[model samples]
Target: MTPAPRDRILDATLTCVARVGLGKTTLDDVAREAGLARATLYRYFPGKQPLISALVAREAARLGADLLEATAACRTLEDAVVELVTTAVASLEAHAALQYVLLVEPEVLLPYLAFRRADDFLREASALVAPALEAFLPSDRVARAAEWLVRVVQSYACSPTAEVDLNDPVSVRVLVTEFVLPGLVPSNMLGVTS
Candidate 1:
């Protein structure tokens, strides 16, 4: 079945946002892209901020699903971190919504995708990496660790020390494991042998 006009508008806008950036995308652009009238665009979006909010929300849900799937196979906490790092870096390179969040509207990512309390965001994030992290971190720290991973990935992507290779997703993945993951581990165990 064909999607509703609102959904169609969103789809077209997402494609445009991914390609031209959310700041540059216009109602006219979305209308042309969606094959709708400008007035019709207003019928759905009302304004740019509403459209942007919908786009960001939809993208967050999509990425959350992807993150859940990618980390499902993880067997250990380090493995979970590795999978999350790999998947997140790779997603940033491929997904338009993530591109918008990472490259254009970073504030969208700041909210962390929890429809409920911000803490729910941490719980959802932890579920993504339960395989590896369930064993490594204490119960109380699991959610906190999840939030940390999310922030670390964004920082890594935005870091100026070395640019992430858009084509080589592993470059950022490796960077995450080497630099960020170690810090997430507790310091009291540092003296212990691996």
Candidate 2:
């Protein structure tokens, strides 16, 4: 089955962005990569910014789907969280366009990741993650816990530390056990009855 024109355009945009940083990518470039005319591209997306915004939204949805799939088979919340963090780290690291942008055009992302705009990113990410956590967290507590998890995962993912390696399962499990789980699940729940 063929991808829809919009998806094809976004995929082509990612390829073009990966080849050349976002700053250098042009609509002509995307059109060429997509094998579509510049006019057709324009018909779908009015302008460059709109195209980029659509691409970002598509990627976020993809990430959300991937996270849900990764956590689906986990029998415990701890396992789910470990899978979530690990999958997020791997996904971000493996995204060619995103890695290229981060390496060469970080300023493009700064507006969304920093300052007041960051709250929007946090809110969106929290919403994406909150549903997955619903099984483990009370309905009232899920949003805050998801936001905190996003903040922690984002911090470690964006500016990694020597003390904790997000790629290492054991290290991630330890971080979850020591920090994440304790915050999400109360001591009363985590404590052994015996």
Candidate 3:
């Protein structure tokens, strides 16, 4: 299926980022991937920061849906949380927007990593993870739990494992099963959680 205009820009941005890194992902490269002219891209994005912001918004929306669905389907809060965190990490690894932001402009990841909000962009991310957490965990514990899960997600994001190696389902699964799941549950259940 043809990607939508916003998606087209994101796809192009990822492609450009992968090829030349964020520093070289020019408007022309983005336009070429979107199959739109440079002028057309500019009609939407006045400049690179605008384009990057749009891409971040698009990715956040997609991830919000994926996380909510994963969270709702789980039988328990623990299961839901693990599924939610793993889904996010996997999505980041798969989505070029996530990688581009992580690799190119790390400040973009401050919300996920640091949860700072000098601007409101990161708030959408909290909206995505908060509902599931609220469903089972008390409101008081929600922030800390989400913060912990975010760290786990970022751990995988910055894993020393080469992209190809970490791409393996076994390696990805191990991260959650060994590291994340245990951490989520108290030490007693750590053995049984598996």
Candidate 4:
């Protein structure tokens, strides 16, 4: 299927961001890349910030869906959390535009990393994980656990520590099971809950 105009614009924006970095990419660049006039681009995205925001939201949704699919077979809460974190980190690391923005133009992302946008990411991530968590935790606890998982995943993405091997699935799974699961799941239930 042909992509919508908005999607084309976002794709162009990401391409431009990857090439020039978000700090330098402009509406003109995105419009040219999308094969649209500046006015047409404006119709889809009024300004650069809104366009970037849309791109971020779209990418995050895609990643969240991928996480859900990747963990669909998980039989336990720990397994799900480990899969979620590992998948999220891997996805973020593989996103070229996102990596460019984070590594070379972090300031472009700083404003969106604040309370409102951060909460948006957290809410989406929480929603994605909530269903898996429902079998083992209360609704409120599930939400909190999801939020914690999102925070930890984001932390690793933004500033990975040398101690952990993010590339190794077994290493990530062990780390989450040992350090993260205990905090999110009550000790008594952790051993048996799925």
In terms of lDDT, which candidate is strongest? 2
lDDT of 1 by residue, 1-194 (tens): 98999889999998887787766788899999999999999988899999988876676666666766776675555555666677666766777645665667866555664345556655555555444355556666766677777666545555534555523546655655566666766767533312
RMSD in order of candidates:
6.1, 2.1, 5.5, 2.6
TM-score, each model?
0.65, 0.94, 0.66, 0.85
Error of 4 at 69 (Å): 1.4
Candidate 4 on 1-194: residue-level lDDT in tens?
Answer: 97999999999988998898988898999999999999999988899889988997798678767877877888888777777777777887888898898889887677556687877767876786666566657666888898887777767666788877776778888888889888886788776765
- Cα distance off (Å), candidate 1, residue 138: 4.1
Off by over 4 Å in 4: 111-136
Segments in model 2 whose C-alpha atoms lie over 4 Å from true places = 191-194
lDDT of 3: 0.67
lDDT of candidate 3 over 44-66, digit per residue (tens): 78899998777666767778788
Q: What stretches of model 1 exceed 4 Å from their correct place?
A: 96-138, 160-194
TM-score of 1: 0.65
The candidate scoring highest on TM-score is 2
The per-model lDDT (C-alpha) reads 0.68, 0.89, 0.67, 0.80
Best of the two (1, 2) by lDDT: 2
Model 2, residue 36: displacement in angstroms? 0.7
185 Cα displacement, candidate 1 (Å): 5.0
